[model samples]
Target: MFQRLFITHPASVGETYFEHMRASLGTAGKLARASAACLVHAIVPGLCKTTGSTAIMALHSEIYPRRFDQPTL
Candidate 1:
């Protein structure tokens, strides 16, 4: 069995959000990390720093890709 995950977001937010994620999560974090990453990351950017925290979720799929650079191994 295999799984794949799709991560996307609007490009309207400033790059700081992405940079924060790149710093906090690091590249490899994406693997063990959950789908919640998308929403969690987006929360700060979308909320304009008004809020401090958010809840996220993960979708389990048999064909979801674990990493962006490589397909499920």
Candidate 2:
């Protein structure tokens, strides 16, 4: 049950638990920064004109190649 809860999903994506944790945290940090930039852009339209969209596109590019069922060697 512990393994299923903490390990399965990460393993399915070809990462160990700690690796997955690090990756998830990094992604969250990026999203948070992007969100802040977006909020700033909303208030002052001229600044950070493409920050949000660029961040989203970069994130999509980073994630698009990952397969959920990648075989682990």
How many steric clashes between backbone atoms does each model show? Answer: 8, 0
Evaluate residue 44 in candidate 2 and report its C-alpha lDDT on the 0 to 100 scale: 100
- Please list the residue runs of candidate 1 whose C-alpha ends up more than 4 Å from where it truly belongs after superposition: 1-34, 46-73
Residue 32 of candidate 2: its Cα lDDT? 97
lDDT (10s digit) by residue, model 1, range 2-73: 112213221222335456456336534533353354445576555323222222122223114432443322
**TM-score leader:** 2
Q: Candidate 1: TM-score?
A: 0.17
The local distance difference test score of each candidate is 0.36, 0.90
Q: TM-score of each candidate?
A: 0.17, 0.87
